[model samples]
Target: MDFGEYDNRKNRKVESGVPDVCKSEPCMMGIDEAGRGPVLGPMVYGTCYCPIAKSSLLKTIGFADSKTLTEEQRDNLFVKLDAEKANMGWLINILSPNYISNSMLKRNKYNLNSLSHDTAIGLISRVLELGINLTEVYVDTVGDFNSYQAKLKSIFPNIDIVVSKKADSIYPIVSAASICAKVARDKAIKNWKFIEGDLFHQFDYGSGYPGDPKTKQFLSENIDPIFGFPQFVRFGWSTASSILDTKALPVKWSSKKAIENSIKTPVISNFFGVQKQETVKEKSHKFFSERCLKSVKNLF
Candidate 1:
């Protein structure tokens, strides 16, 4: 519940329970994300796992899709989940709005779907790293359940991976993951401390979706003539960028032409449009392709 850690790192995790107990039993894990569609706060990836036999206990506590639960009900369930710490574990990965915008707007265009997949994979990897005897994983699908499922399976060949359109509703573990993500995101938004000096002071950004009139009002009212938006806004989102392009002053980068040449196109980009159509792709280092690292011209 501490925002201090999150304030320091745009990306951070909240972990509950240690792994020693999990190492004794076969575990089932689930992952779901929150705030993906919002033009506001961080997009969060949540994961929770328990002994396969104890998963039924999750259903007993009324873990269900976060969207269906009232804020009070979700809060109550979040507390209940923590009370079950003896047999369950959970982790939340918070990807800040700034990080999301940076990744999506990077010269190579990292894109959301790729970011989601990578974040989900990283969560699973974290569970494994903590020494859990993980055997199964359930995921709420992001794009093309079949392809996404296949991709997860390929990376984690030993685990039984299931990606379903409504896994968050169908699986108690996935629902629990949704609760983890939703509650954390809500807390993050409520306590957000703008490093950008006082502009407007309020937590009235509405639902943070593009369609919300209050959110529209907030974006329009807060726009800076020279700078695009505060870090809280996802500057790369079409919802935010479309406004910036029309309202904010234009800024240009010097490395508009070239930087890392050896990076190859991400496979997920083939499914979603993240590539430059007119610009011919440049080849990347074999090491870069193999390790997902890119050579930067400068550290700054």
Candidate 2:
């Protein structure tokens, strides 16, 4: 699309010399994500791509592991990226907490790992569609590295793909991706607009981690009776689940058996009008337990 028009903030993307970046020169792209562990805010997947020869320029610009850099340092690097738009390009996908929670809560259960893998694959495919000649891709991962790498290889057979635990520290390009992703996630949390009320009015949920006392307190106190917390909270997380199950009203989720057996099917004896009384064996609690176990085992 309009790569030049893409902005960095507010979940914007930008690129330059589209055709040249697309297929005219061999390029390498780095993939990294932020906010995966957070219970609040959106998870951001970011990818940065450049011509293979200029990858070293990433180090020259002071791009390194995002975690090691201070917030100001990350901002400065992004500023440099903006200045050198011709050589570097990046894009990001912001995944809302509501979307993540809903995915996991679905009947078929699409977990976070699956969502992450799909998002990364989508980013790579999007770059290729824009006509960028992506020859190699390096990705940072918290899950199974080999499986994720294999999955990317299966999808993009021609391109080389490498998935590592801390590739963000090892690869400059991935480090760049990490910075972009982190900045995007931080902005999302800071700029969060709550549907219930003003975000600033709500207690500061520090970093949205379970270990953060502020975050825990915010989650425990801010839970809504009807809607749960605002859109920024991942309600399906274990932290939220513990509070909900014990403190909030009980909620019964439907299952396959519950849906199919809304009304119990009448036995043949009922149709025949037979008056078979409950036997002494059937009256015993153990007999009911045995019958329930049989039914459960049948389903499996």
Candidate 3:
């Protein structure tokens, strides 16, 4: 929860100790994401799993909608979650903003949906590899509900995959995951350290949503003109990209492939393949050169 070195761009994971239920009996897991809509901070993927027979215990902890709960309320729920560590397990994957921007902006263009899918798949795969007896997976839908459901089923044919509209609110395990994700995201943003410079030591950038007035003002006031916004912002986002296009100086970058292709090659370079090019010589070798009497093998 400390989220030390918040400015680091690396992706990271946090998890609870393996629950006894998961290893001993068939389990059901839920997957949910947080911070997907925010213009700032890392997007988080969280998963929770427990014995199918005992999953109802999660509901008793009042793990409903995390968005409706106060910060203190959510924190209390998270504490309760740890108390149930013997019966259930939770894991989180934090995707840094810079990483999100770079992945979306790269030449091949990894879209957000694909990123989300991969993250969920990876978390489940990791849990299975750890020898958990996961029998079912419930997920809040991404993109098309059925398509997403099918994709997950293909990857985990042996598991019952349920991709629904709002799994977090409907399922106890997913609600647990929702709380874990929200708590981690809140802690991350509250502790975010700007690695850019001292200028942002105490500046308040509220909410980190594109529509938030404070966040908008903070972004507008801090534009670098030459470098655009700091690395804390997702440059690939349209909210930031528009500012760069209109306010920040235009930066046209030559791609690595373009730069490599632009280098001039010598006109004769092709002639020096595996063998060196030899100069023209007398037709009859050294004897013809001395006598100027070239012997023609066949005169047409």
Candidate with top lDDT is 1
Residues 1-300, candidate 1: write the lDDT tens digits. 454644612687889876466888999999999999999889999988999988788989989999998888888898998888788889999998878887887889798999999999999999999999999999999899999999999999999999999999999999999999999888888777666565544647799999999998889888877755777888788889888888988887556334444445678757777665687778995434422346776643
Better of 1 and 2 by lDDT: 1
* lDDT: worst 10-residue window of model 3: 285-294
Query: What is the C-alpha lDDT profile of model 3 across 55-75, one tens digit per residue?
Result: 778878888867779999989
lDDT of 2 at 130: 85
Task: Give per-residue CA lDDT, model 2, range 1-300, as digits (tens).
Answer: 122332222244433344354367899999999889888777888888889988778989888888888888888887786566677788878776766787888779798899999989989988988888899999998589998999899999999999998999999999989988887776666666554557535687787888899999998888867545666678789998888777777777778778678757778777688667776753435323321223333332
Candidate 2 runs further than 4 Å off? 1-22, 199-202, 252-300
Worst 10 residues of 2 by lDDT: 1-10
- What is the lDDT, from 0 to 100, of the residue 96 in candidate 2? 69
User: Which lDDT values do the candidates have, in the order given?
Assistant: 0.85, 0.77, 0.83
Q: Clashes in model 2: which pairs? A: 22-131, 22-132, 22-133
Error of 3 at 201 (Å): 4.8
Task: Judge candidate 3 against the unseen true structure and give its global Cα lDDT, from 0 to 1.
Answer: 0.83
- CA displacement after TM-score superposition, residue 73 of candidate 2 (Å): 1.0
Clashing pairs in 3: none
Instruction: Name the top TM-score candidate.
Output: 3
What's the residue-level lDDT of 215 in candidate 3? Answer: 78
| Residue ranges of candidate 3 with Cα displaced over 4 Å | 252-300
TM-score of each: 0.82, 0.78, 0.83
